[model samples]
Every structure is written in C-alpha cells, then in structure tokens.
Target: MTFRDVVALWLVKEKRATDVVLAACDLLVAGEGGEAVARLAALTRLEADIEVPILLPEVMRELDLPHHSRGTVEGREEGLRAMAVRVLSGELTPRELTKWTHRMFGHEDEGWRLSELDDAYDTQAVDSDEALDAEVMAEVRRITS
Candidate 1:
C-alpha cells in the first residue's frame, strides 16, 4: 500500500490519540518523499498542539538498523529512505515497530530488569501467598526506608 493508504488504515483501525502519534512517527521515519511530508503537514494542521518525539534512534534499533552521523546529510537521507522502504513494504508492521521501539528504548517492561522481575513473580519463584507478601513488604520497605 502507499504510505498515505497505510496511515488511513491505521487511523481507521486504531482510532486513538496514540494512533496519530504512531502515524507521524511512521511518516517521519519512512521519509517517503513529499507524500510522507504532506501527511505530516496535514496532521500538523489538524492538531497543531501535539508533541512528537524524535524517535529516530529507537526506530533504527527496532529495525535492527543504525543511525547516520550528523556529519553527512546524504547519509541521513539514505537511512531515512531505508526506513521508509521497510515500512511501506509491510516488512514491518506498526505494532511490531512499536514493540521493538519500546524494548529498545526501555519504554516497556521487557528489559533485563523487568524480565528479572517477571521471572521472580513466576509461580515457581513464589510457592505461597506468604512468600509473595514478604517480597512485597520487602520492596515496600526498601522504597520507604
């Protein structure tokens, strides 16, 4: 699908505040010439107050990609073009992109520390309610003390 078509689909399917944010991120990362720019412009007109983060680094890591140094404009353009191609070709879905982004940037509870917490919370780790309560009490004490 064309870039605009994908954005439209996303809007219709998701229809949340975050969907707009995701669409803008996709457009900026894709950098598919004027069309992507145009969509961003339209979105800006619709909601001039929204905040957009510079998520290039997160996007790059999610795509198992790299960033272009600021020394070369050409390199930056090339990286954006590669990102655009991946998004447009359906090689990367927005949800997958978002998840990868969260994991890469530590936005989600999937990092090493969070994973350790999950492991600790597993049934095998705590054999009874008393153990769980003790763990929680210890954490509470650590935080308050």
Candidate 2:
C-alpha cells in the first residue's frame, strides 16, 4: 500500500491526535509539504477535537506549525524510540510510556510494526504502580540500548 493510503487508514481507524501528530512528523521528515499540509488540515477538520499541534520543536519551527507533544499505530519503532528518548530525558514518565505502549500494542501491523519490541510490548500490567513504571522503564532501556 502507498504511504498516503496507510496514513488514510490510520486516520480512519485510530482518529487519535497522536496518529495525526505522528503522520505530520513523518511528512515533515520526508520534506513533504503543500498537499501534505493540506491533507493534515483536512484531517483535523474531519476529526473532531484532534490536537493539531506538532510534536517536534524543530519540525514545528521549520514548518511554521503549532507545537504539542504526541504517532502512527508502521512507526511503532519510531514511536517507541521517541518515547524512550523523552523518558530518558525526563520529558515523559514511565507511567506515560506504559500507557502509550499498551495503546500501540493494539495496532500492530495495521498502523505500526515492531520486531524487537513485539514480544515485550504489551507485557505491561493493567494496574499503574511504581513497579509497573519500573517495568516500562526497563523496556524503554531495551529500546534505547
């Protein structure tokens, strides 16, 4: 399938702000503008209450887009890496990673895919706790290392 088709599918299926943000990030990274920007704008209009702010500061400045923190459900590894960087840099908490990872677990191969993290991805417990956070952090360490 085409990249746009994949993104369109993600928008239709997930319709989450994170998905939009991640798609926008991918567009920015690929140097796609004009039609891409229009597509994202159209997406924001179609999806109610989606956070339109871009996540990466550099991308925001370069693209002149709004700023916010947020992903696709194929970019799983990239999403994990981004979250891991945030966790290691004190920008994101372990609890947050745990939550995001669990959410992403549902979209494997549809929105995103993972090999290294596939087995360990959804291993996080349902309950939130320090120990759970630690488990997530260990997973983060694995991603980063």
Candidate that scores best on lDDT: 2
Quick one: RMSD of model 1?
Answer: 15.5
- Local accuracy of candidate 2 as per-residue lDDT tens digits, 1-145: 2233233333334335545555664675677755435445455444624434332344345456433333443345544555666678897786666556556665455212232233344463354455556666676777778
TM-score of each: 0.21, 0.38
Best by TM-score: 2
Q: Would you list the clashing residue pairs of candidate 1?
A: 30-84
Cα deviation at 39, candidate 2, in Å, is 20
> Model 1 residue 99 lDDT?
35
Per-residue lDDT tens digits of candidate 1, residues 1-145?
Answer: 3333333333223223345345555656676334434444354533633422233334334434444433244342332233334444666543343333233324232232322333444544544645543543343333223
Q: Model 2 reaches what TM-score against the true structure? A: 0.38
